[model samples]
Target chain A: MPLVDIQLIEGVFTEAQKKGMIEKVTDAMVEIEGEAMRGVTWVRVQEFRSGAWGIGGKGLTTEDVRALTS
Target chain B: MPLVDIQLIEGVFTEAQKKGMIEKVTDAMVEIEGEAMRGVTWVRVQEFRSGAWGIGGKGLTTEDVRALTS
Candidate 1:
């Protein structure tokens, strides 16, 4: 079974986007693991509090992530 | 950067258990990746709705998982 966990800063993504991510990520894994594994492929989205995600010794907030996106 | 994602059936674990998981998983990765990488190490726990996780072509509910534990 392939388990894919996606972490995002809280409030950064809409529920629709998260659902899309789950579908696309599962499809991507199935592409490599083969279609038969789709039933066993698990994709879950985990959200961290705004200041809990860190990179380069600094915690990142939703604003930080959104700034990078734009 | 090492990212560790743990998936569990929702409502089975307490907040403290999840916190402990994040700590232990992070330590487990640091043991392999080295202490310097701790800052970049990310351990996330994602909980799936009961009946969302599947194994052996069958969807597993929270009770199924709890049954296995007990």
Candidate 2:
């Protein structure tokens, strides 16, 4: 039961899509283990406006991180 | 602003507490950015039964990850 956190910029999903995404993510976790998901809580998805975020004291966008990660 | 997603076990928060936790997490993101928060979304929390989770093909707990991180 490893707590996994995923952060992303907003607007990538709709209400239903969000539900699906959450389920999918959970599914991935469950795939690794049978009953691994239990008593889990979702904090929130924070959407930062431009200039509201930075990397190493320099402004960076979620796209930037996605690019870096991808 | 990197999209950050936090997944945790349920019951650590109440409805009101969940709201606060969400806000606090958001605040942290915004602190790194002023207008960086906008258009976000929250999916859902998944709880798995025992024997449902594993690490490296063996059962593991969220506390284990927390311990590793801490």
| Leading candidate by TM-score | 1
Residue B31 accuracy (lDDT) in model 1: 80
lDDT of candidate 2 over A7-36, digit per residue (tens)? 555543346544544455445444333332
RMSD of 1: 7.9
Tell me, per candidate, how large a share of the native contacts it keeps.
0.10, 0.30
Candidate 1 structure quality by residue, lDDT tens digits, A1-70:
7898887888888899999999999999999999999999999997876644544324566898888887
Question: How high is the CA lDDT of each candidate model?
Answer: 0.77, 0.44
True contacts kept of 2: 0.30
DockQ, computed on Cα atoms, for candidate 2: 0.15
How close is chain A of candidate 1 to the true chain A, as a TM-score? 0.91
Best by DockQ: 2
Candidate 1's DockQ is 0.11
lDDT of 1 at B48: 83
Which docking band does candidate 2 fall into?
A: incorrect
